[model samples]
Target: MDKNIKVGMADYKVASGEEVLITLGLGSCVGVIIYDSSKKIAGMAHIMLPSSLEIKNNSNKMKFADTCIDLMMDELLKLKVSKTSLKAKIAGGAQMFSVSLNTESLNIGKRNVIAVKEKLKSLNIPIIAEDVLGNHGRTIKFDCNNQQLNIKSIGKGEHII
Candidate 1:
């Protein structure tokens, strides 16, 4: 049987073979998935912020896009997964709140999405698919067996990306 590894908010988890990585309640947060298909290795990070530099006492590295991805890559590299073999998939980053003023600072979700993309690009990881930016929260399951990310949202049903 395959093990299901649950990743929480501001957290991350890595798995291999038949294991599946899952995360829930992704409102304004983003679920960043990175995997090496040939090795059947995968990881998921539920990032709550765009950058760690934006806040004081940001000790939780997993909560930000930049730090979280760097840490996850280190783990993957340790597992003998080459950076060249890595691919990515992302979900969540929803605009959950309705604000009267249309300002970039208020759109944390969009900021997160952009940051994730920038970080991935810096590391030369290609995002194969993504489901992001809506007014709803998301729950995601990353299956290591086939490198597929299954995303579920309220009133949006379920789909694999």
Candidate 2:
């Protein structure tokens, strides 16, 4: 039987075999899924911020994209998963509210997405697919067995990436 592992906001989880990683309520937050398909190993991070460097109270490493991905990579490496074989699939980072200001600082969703991509590139993990930058929140689940990311959004329905 497959176990459903929940990755909460500002948190991360790693799994292998038949385990599935899931995260919910990703509004202005990004759900990053990194996996080694050959080993059936996967990690999911629900990142609330782009970088931990910009925040003073940055104790939680999983709260930021840069730190979270690094930590997840370390975990995967310990599991005998090679960095070269890792691939990523991301969802969420939605612009949930309308903002009159055109300032980039207010667009946390876009910033989160950008930070995630940058971190993944720095690690040489190519992103296989992504569903990001929209006005709807998302709930995501990553299946380790088949290496599929299932994304669900309100009124937007659900789809696999």
Candidate 3:
């Protein structure tokens, strides 16, 4: 919802039409959320890592992008939300790397973005919109009722889709 809502690291929230979910400070992490207007369904996640393989014991599912998205989808299904009609949007992934000026393009943020896209592709989920890659952070808000996404860079305008 909109009243001082807060989603900490590796956290997600779901609600219906009456609520608005938002998250900020997405750099190498991704905000993968889905909205289904007809079903009045919505879900959001903040994925801090790129894959589950890094965790050999199936630990901390929310930390990995793939597992995080799956977690969101799994919960949405429990609400009777069908994946066939689900629409996904992703944001965040900046060159948060300080490796070297020559490696500015090798930020983990870009890797995270690519990982999310690959995961979605494997799941047959289409990305309706995205605002990824750069040397900055991102803030995202999803209005579930209307399936609208509001994306904003730190000092730029909020983009609506």
Runs with alpha carbons beyond 4 Å of true place in candidate 1: none
State the RMSD for candidate 2: 0.9
Question: What TM-score would you give candidate 3 relative to the actual structure?
Answer: 0.87
lDDT tens digits, residue span 1-161, model 3: 24324556688888787677788888888888776768878888888878788668668888888788888888888999877888788888777657755663356687788888898888877899888877778888788777787888877767887
Candidate 2 wrong stretches, greater than 4 Å: none
lDDT value, candidate 3, whole model: 0.79
TM-score of 2: 0.97
Off by over 4 Å in 3: 1-5, 55-58, 101-106
- Per-residue accuracy of model 2 over 63-82 as CA lDDT, tens digit each: 99989899988888999997
Please give the range of 10 consecutive residues that has the lowest summed lDDT in model 1: 1-10
Query: Clash number for model 2?
Result: 0
For all predicted structures, in order, the TM-scores are: 0.97, 0.97, 0.87
